[model samples]
Target chain A: MIFPALRVLVPVALVIALVAIGLRIGDALGIGPDPAFTLLAGALFGVLLQRSRFCFYCILRELFEDRDSRASYGLLVALAVGSLGYVAMFGSWVADPGAGRLPPDAHIGPVSWVLVVAGLAFGIGMTLSGSCISAHLYRLGEGSVLSPFALVGALAGFVLGFASWDHLYVETISRAPTEWLPARFGYGGAVLLQLAVLGALALLLMRRLPARPARDAAAWRLRAVLDAVFVRRWPAWVGGAGVGMLGFIAYFRTSPLGVTAELGSRARTLAERLDLIPGRLAGLDGFSGCATVVIDALMTENGVFILALVAGSLAAAIGAGAFRPRRQPLHRYPLALLGGVLMGWGAMVALGCTVGVLLSGISAFALSGWVFGAAVVAGVWVSLAVRNRVRMRLSARHPAG
Target chain B: MSTLSKSLRRTAALLLALPLLAAGQAVADGPVVSTSWLAERLGDERIRVVEVSVEPGRFERGHIPGAVNFRWHTDLVDPVRRDIASPEAFSKLVSEAGIDADTTVVLYGDHNNWFAAWGAWIFDLYGHDNVVLLDGGRDKWQRENREMSRRPARHAATDYQLDVAKPELRARLADVLEVVEGEHRAALLDIRSPAEFEGRIFAPPGIQELAIRAGHIPGAKNVPWDRVVRDDGTFRDTEELRRLYADIGIDGSDPVIVYCRIGERSAHSWFVLSRILGYEARQYDGSWTEWGNAVGVPIDNPAGTVWGGT
Candidate 1:
């Protein structure tokens, strides 16, 4: 038992120590403390995501298929918490909430039909791939064989997005409205309204939640504590609250909590280098989501954050004994790739993935966020229904098998 | 001393002083300085370093030691109008930035000194006599691992007065229109990317300020601003620059009017033409934004691209 426990504890401890030392060295090198802080934030986020199993697609699917509203509640709680934190930050940053000027570097993207289309595609991609982009990152730590193919597919999708960007920009995105909730209602008003909406949704979801088993009271013991920490999956609300707090802290310290900026930037840089895309992608830079740029430096803030996120998730997964690598069937590879491509293109067009546009956007109280979230939900629902119908028909035809 | 001997002696003295005078003038009036030159004179009281990067908060992150930051949007332009800063505002800005009449202002910035050249143009407009661009600007300095400081430099403020505004240095919309209509003899130089010049795109991706229409002024020669700079962001030698322009019949004999999407990029080209290669040039500060958006301006768009159309 001691040897087995050491196998989990030693690696996790080494990871934490290495992170601490890396932060110190990074600060000493004159890159400033922002990168170090971002690394820490990403690590914390990874641990929370992995331990809580806070996957957007998984939660939504569970709600639709199994009528499990528990994980969905966690997501709502995260949004609510994030929204409250954002309002507080916004209040301090811009005293007059009605001011037309947006808080700098917030994920307030333009609202348009393109965003809806992107969100739908992303949702469908999530369904097909079995994870959202953020989920793929965490699950990569969990040794998901398909995550690599999906990520590669996403890179290709970004290239495709660059190809299609100019026409779309001219048609719709150029004229799209960037709606900030605080601009319409005051900070207090905006938070309250968002909370009310979230509350209503939460109540609606609660009706579908299955009854929980009563907890058996036990005396406090070291073994029990270790089991709870390392063996048991965290409650949905705990993960939701952790995620929300992290999002707030991330925005306050660094930029917004985004995972795809680095990925998109890499794709953009590569595409530009290969001359695969046009020299100019019109209106791509003006609007803020996860704005992609041609690579100038080896390490960007987002790049470092993502690297640390993976590392942190790996540590958590190891400790939880959840880093189980399983061989997937051959056919699932193609689906993962296709799904990744869809998600990549969607994220590129929309300027962010689930974590970037939906989570961060909604927290910042941008109307685009809510629109994206609704569209994503509708997409997931529709795709799941269609898939279920297809499966049923196939099974009906092959009853003996 | 006889009269003949006195005149000969005087001539000899004047001839001896010619090279010395020329060298002194070069030191004082040259429009661009290399990094080593500026680095050697880091703490010289007569020199002031100014950063005018397009990206916000870059100055705060790190800049050349003792350099002051000037935000392009608010500091360089009129807050209320779509124009350069008013005379009074410009005076106040210079005064607050510790610039004086005798100060040799060394300007540098990010994006290969795109906005820094704009600053130089503005300085020229206001007739600052001793201003020079730091050759290669901030990019080269940073790439070479020069020292940078986050601490804001504190310098004693001086009452920096604006000299007579140089009107010939700037070209207005009417001036560009006259050139387009064949009334002016000046050569029209569009310094935007080929895509922008050919009307395939309205503006560079991610740039907010855009024209309603896409294309260049009719008969304008396309030479992207970046053609003047090397990979390291330093300006190419005089001979190369001259050859580049001479290919399009701009051999410095003809007055050149340079323009880009906005005036900033054109200012870079204007710096190259007027300062580096000694050409008679005026920056059409209005540029494509003014030309393309004007109600009935004649434009030569090869791609035939239209706004809101495929």
Candidate 2:
């Protein structure tokens, strides 16, 4: 038992030590302190997300299919905690919320029909691909074969999005209203409104949640401690709270908690180099949701953060002995590729993914966040319904099997 | 080897070196200085390097050694009003930044020296003849892996005075209006994006400062400011720039009025025309913000885009 625990503990300890040394000497390597801090924050977020199974698609699918709203509750708790944290930060930053001055680098974005379309596409993509973008990133560490295809498909989708960006920007996105809740309702009022909405959603979800199971008392021993550390999954609320705290600290110390900026930037750069996209992405730079730029620097905050996230997830997955690589059917690959394309296009048009736009946007009290979330839920429900019907029809035809 | 012969030889040597010295001074007095030129004279007493980036905190992160930061929002512009800094304020800023009448101020910044060009305009307005822009600015320097420092530059304050504000270099709303009404005989150069000039969008997609009306001043030629700079953020060669401007019929014959969404971008064009090409050009700093928003002003919106209209 001690030997197994040591195997798990050593790798995790080594990862932490390496991260510490990197942070200490980051400036010398042209990685500024801000990006270094982002790396730390991203790693912690990756661990929390993986341990709690905090995939938005998984959470929503479980709620709809199994009537298990436990993970949904975690998402709600995260939103509630994050909103409160944001309001506190906003209050200190802007004495008067009505002053029309927005906090710098928040994920507040424009609300428009394009955003809704993006959200819906993202939802359907998540259902088909079996995970959201951030989830796929962590699951890559868990040795998921589909994640790579999905991510690559997403890159291709970004190029497509860039190709279509001008038309969309000219038509509707240019005129879209960027609605910040704090601008109308004060910071306190905005946070209260968010909490109320989250609370009401929590109550609605609570009705469908399965009852809690009975727990057995266990002796406090070394084996039990080791098992809890290396085997047991963290509770939903614990992960939610941890994520919320991290979101606040990330925003306060660096920029917002976003993951798609680096990916989008890379895709944009690749497209530009290949001449697959226009020279200038029309009006792309002005909006704030994980804005992508033509890459000039060797390291960006988001770039380092993403790399650290994958590393951290790998470390955590290894410690838990959950790094299992399995082969999948050939047919599933195309589905993942298709799904990734949809998600990539959706993320680009929407200006972010679940983590950047939905989580960080909601935390910033942007109306776009809530609107995108609702649209995503609708898309998922509709996709799931269609899939179920197809499966039922196929099963009925093969009743002999 | 007599004393009289030795003195005669020395005089001849000094005469021979005069032309070389003057040629060197001519290069130093030009509108733009190369990265190598500035790099060699980083700590020279006569030179003062100023960084005026569009984005905040860029200077504090890492900047050229011995460069002082001048935030575009607070340091360059008027704190409250939508205008350039006043003469008195400019004087204080220059004096505090340790710039004197004779100091060769080398301005550089991010976004291809967009705000740094504006700084040069400001310095020019105050009759600082020795001011020049760092060619390619911060982008090129960083790309070349030039030395940078996080330490704030410290220089003893000088008693800099604003003696002559060059009104000829700045175009006001009335001047632009005259051009729009066909009363003025200057070339109206719109340096904003084509989408902006055509009224497809009010401003750049995410830009907060906007004009209610969308379009260019009637008859303004659309040559985006970015065309003047190479991919590396440096200005194009003189012959190429001449040919590019000549295609639009903006020869040195007629005075040119350059304008953009705001004044900063136009200042870049203003630098190219006035300083680089030596054209009789003026920067309409009020630009589209003043022209597009002003009621009863004539606008030629090619796209016919209306606010909140399908």
Candidate 3:
């Protein structure tokens, strides 16, 4: 009620943002990157995210508390479908094992354990913060109070991350390999490994479809394999495919789909200009390199891509007739701020978010995604425990406030 | 409802609604030309291409057949700061480049079309209705087919008409700063990376002060410029573009001021926001490069950022 229009408009707005991202990437590459294509895709995502109520937190919660994996199943299916598309288009990796350029920031380079710890931190932190990196990206579009804090915190965490780099690099990172996916399983093997692993997960979800009726309608997303196959109908799949296709096409334009590097560079630029920080943040620059930041500085590249994603999502929201923004209880603001800071910190420490580090990394056949995802989930759980105790204390005190 | 249900409901509902009218001209039908289209128009005396690349002399070293090098850092931008050239001076520069109201101009350069876009912004500002940025730029052209490079450019000067076309299209430094301060509620857009917005330190000295105390202009939003571009330096579609704007808090009436250090990068975003997606987007030509380093402007950077907004 506080921000009425925003509440009703948020989801759609977020979808539009993503679609615009696609279109912008399209333009950056000059590959007929039509805003229309991204627009429609955004609409589709809006519809899906809205209809399915897809939140990784909810999925994890169900899995953790109710022993339900329905939401998790849906997510896996989406990833499987999308990852297949990514590999099919780009192939495993460029030729010349030693020479070819891999996807930007996809692999966790020489920071294996640190990355794993970061991922776990993110996973758990997302739960505690009440949203994952990708979810927050869109949720902010929807006017979530906690979203801003999370974002701010992320920024703070990144700034602070500079302080720890020397240690992270010397003790934890220097000894590790950057491209674990390649080291463990050559390019071809890694691509195949993804298919095998995710393919298996997809099959497991398929088998669970029959038991859906036993669970509450809200709890069960689909009827396992059959519904997973047919329930979402063509639109959801199309929308998901569109995002995946956009991801594929993104490879042709600038770098593969990434959000963190851009965010990081933007953050760095602000710190320097505003004097919010010292002129330099120490080891971060050398670790990341100038080309990466320069690409993020591109006005028409990542900037437009993010724009398209949001705009496209908004359009999708409009088409499906579900575009509306809703304000959550204001009491959540402090928690939101705290949560945001943690997630932001985690994202910074880890070098990316779910979409940035995890998804992008996975697509590149990088092992860092695995590390970040797992660690973030762990962090989320830890945060959630803290929240539970706080909630209990609040309930004991005022019962409602 | 619990947070989960609330989130799910919001997501579902968002997937189900209708949006407002297309963000005014936020839906840009800006012309995108292929290398082929450029080649066809190359030799025509009426056409001029502007090479806007980042490298020191990328434009001077080689360019499209009949193109002129527009040094984003030097010519199109104010030497004092990232602010755009004054209108009178801007038009004269256009003419000096052999471009006119009727000149069929094509823009392209290295690093996708990032630099090239700054040139396009120049055209838009001066009301040169006949300019089009080469889609996919030379990088893509080189990939799909053979590429052409003009011999190093030769100096040519002509008396150009300092035509007053549309001064309103630009966002003055004051205007940008005002919006950033949340005075006019102008949607301050950082076309740079999140790091840049967060003051992660790496800003060139010229634009350091414009950064907010904490990070970002308290109310400013970020939409990295790369989001608008592709790997091969091409752009995405319109529908997608609209979505991108929505995601980044860009509303048609939001009064957006897009900026990057010297405004060259911001110009690229300016094109995307104003030209493609058709939002009332203006480029803060002075960007951080000027405002950040301005003598007495309010500067905010708390030692907590990478660039430090110093």
DockQ of each: 0.05, 0.04, 0.02
Supply candidate 3's per-residue lDDT for B86: 69
lDDT of 3 by residue, A62-100 (tens): 666565655666555555555665555434333333444
Whose TM-score is greatest here? 1
Q: What is the C-alpha lDDT of each candidate?
A: 0.85, 0.84, 0.59
Ranking by TM-score: 1, 2, 3
The better-scoring model by TM-score among 2 and 3 is: 2
Ranked candidates (DockQ, high to low): 1, 2, 3
> Candidate 1: global Cα-lDDT?
0.85
- Tell me the tens digit of each residue's lDDT in model 1 across A267-304: 99999989999766887877767998777677777887
What's chain A's TM-score in each predicted model?
A: 0.95, 0.95, 0.72
Query: What residue runs in model 1 are displaced by over 4 Å at the alpha carbon?
Result: A1-6, A13-17, A24-33, B1-54, B57-71, B74-82, B86-310
Candidate 1's docking class is incorrect
- Writing each residue's lDDT as its tens digit, candidate 2 over B44-111 gives 76789999998754665578999888878877888688778888888998898898887889999988
Candidate 3, TM-score vs. the true structure? Answer: 0.49
- The 10-residue segment of model 3 chain A with minimum total lDDT is A288-297
Model 2 chain B TM at 0.91
- Going through the candidates in order, the fraction of native interface contacts each one reproduces equals 0.00, 0.00, 0.00
Q: Poorest 10 consecutive residues of model 1 chain A by lDDT?
A: A25-34
Give candidate 2 regions above 4 Å deviation: A1-10, A13-17, A28-33, A219-222, B1-53, B56-310
